[model samples]
Target: MTKLLFLVADGMGDWPVAELGGRTPLEAAPTPNMDALARRCVAGTARTVPQGMAPGSDVANMSLMGFDPAAHHTGRGPIEAAAQGLELDPDDLVWRLNLVRVAGHGPGDAMLDYSSGHIDTGRSTPLVEDLQAHLGDAVFSFVPGIQYRHLLVQRGGARAPEAALDIRPPHDITGQPQGPDLERFASSPRLAELRRAAARRLEAPANTTQANAIWPWGQGRPLLLPAFRQTFGLRGAVVSAVDLVRGLGRASGMEVAEVPGATGLLDTNYQGKVDAALEFLARGGDFVFLHVEAPDECGHSGVTADKVEAVRRFDERIVGPVVRALQGEDAALLLTCDHFTPLARRTHTPDPVPFLLHHPRLADHALPAFSEAGAAATGLTLERGHDLLPHVLERLRG
Candidate 1:
């Protein structure tokens, strides 16, 4: 049986930028390895984010992994909670509490930084501990996760209709005034109190560029889904640095492989992840999903050059090594992004992303490049992202 590799470069899609002379980051980057792979593969566009759904990584990744987001996605909170090993009851409501920075004390203050300047785990962990000590009670609890990303669980709160509060992701409103949203949350005396206390307690003297507030959003209950192996008839593993991906892997009954230096940043251990994926396949695994988040972070920060460099690194470090390792092997490789985190908007867009499917037994398509424009030029597109996985599997088995 042939092995399969599904590689996701998060937020790799981008709109044309004036700074790069009308070329998107993926097009502008010098990704010779990816371009070469395109020549020997079938390339096309796929809509990962379904209609009327928010363009979040949770939804897009679910679709990419062959799970229908409309049916499988509960929310991001439950996924991250699973990653932290926190079990949730049917009536429990979980929220993703992000350490964010606001400009002023008033409600009209702008959301200055969503990830609290991407604060290190060492500093953010203590702040979460302080919140747990001060704000946690019989009804609510705070659990520390990775840097800036944490969880807040309201036990049995899902039984209340009010638990379905309208919450916005802080990253979606960066540099925008939070007056309306803050005022709405403040209408609840309990939430207001927690917000005020968190602001005061998070103020550390050593923290100059860190967060002073906790922005909670993406609330939902736990989800139960069929195992990946059961659904696809292939034992697989997931290699990613982000908790969301790992949690999805866990929930889908796939092994989650953690790399030592996989920080989900530009400095993440690319070689470590590559090694892990190849090792899993060598050890009788039928499939492996590898994800990288550096391009997404760069898109969120609106850094054009960094986004370009990130794509280059992904091609050189991850894709190149994996291709070289599988030179004499019977394996298949699928490369694509979940969604478009355009630098122009500094947020995710519900746009189709390019995908390349390469297999050693397949004939070369002789494509010119592996990019948005290049894929669009092919005029081949997959209307639904979930269909791509099954199609790849069918082709691989053939």
Candidate 2:
């Protein structure tokens, strides 16, 4: 049997920037390990986002994990809720309530920060608790999650005119006026009232990232997924610091590995995640899905150098160690990004991202490096991201 190691560098793809002489962050970063692997691995591009779908991490990730988003994804809210062990009723409505920083108390103000300065869990928890205490009742409840991400669920089959509302992801509209989006939901009196109440009650404490309001989007009911083992005929494990990834793993019947000091940030515990992936494989697991979120966060902040640094760190700290450990072992390793989080746009795009698949038995068709430019130059592209897994399986078993 061929052991599998699937690694994902979230939002690592970027557009060319003038500062880097028109090279994307991945191209600019000095990723020697990735470059070496590219020399011996199959390099190509894969379109993780389907047509007409939002290029959010949830949709992209689902596609990367070999599930067709159109067939399986309900919404991000339900997937995140699943990560927190929250069971949803058939009629329960779950929405992702992001702690955000707006310019003013009124909706007319611009969204200053989508993640409320990437609010720490300690500071954001109290606010979520307070909201639950003050605003939560029989119909609505607030559930705290990692950092700025949280959940708001509406029970009793109370629909909130979601179809009529123009709710948008806070990250997608950062630095833009939010009044128009808020006004679109004015038809739903209950939602409007809840929004005002949340804004009035939540205030950021001094000297901390300002999480002054809750921006709700990505609403949906719960969903069920076919087990990963049944779908792929391989027992799998998932390692990630983010809830959405962990939730997807749990929902798909994969073991969710937790690593200490894993913060899902630039300073996250890269060694710990590497250790977990190796440990899972050592324990007779068939596959491991390791995800790193730092690159995407850096892209969202529009920091080019930081994004480059993130890619380098992923290449050195995570990919290098895993590649070294797999030496002399019958394993197939795959490294790729789910989608492009371009620093220029400071948001996700539906463009195809680069992927590298390596196996000891296969011949090397080396490239100069594993990057957007190099991958595109190869002209080997997977039109659908979901096809990647099947392709990997074929290479492993062929």
**lDDT by candidate, in order shown:** 0.88, 0.87
- Model 2 alpha-carbon drift over 4 Å, by segment: 156-160, 204-209
Per-residue error (Å), model 2, residue 278: 0.7
Error of 1 at 25 (Å): 0.8
Predicted candidate 2 versus true structure: per-residue lDDT over 225-257, tens digit per residue: 789999999999999999899989998999999
Alpha carbon lDDT at 250, candidate 1: 89
**Per-residue lDDT of 1-398 in model 1, one digit per residue for the tens?**
87889999999999999999999998899999889888888778899998999999998998889999888888899888877778789999888899998997687789999999899888888888878998899878999999889998988877764376777788899999998778767766777788888888777675564789988888888866679999999999999999888989988889999799899999999999999999999889999999999999999999899999999999999999999999988888899999999999999998999999987566546677888988877777888888889888888876
How displaced is residue 284 in candidate 1, in Å?
A: 0.7
Clashes of each: 0, 0
lDDT of 2 at 1: 96
RMSD of each: 1.4, 1.6
> Model 2, residue 8: what's the lDDT?
96
Point to the candidate with the largest lDDT.
1
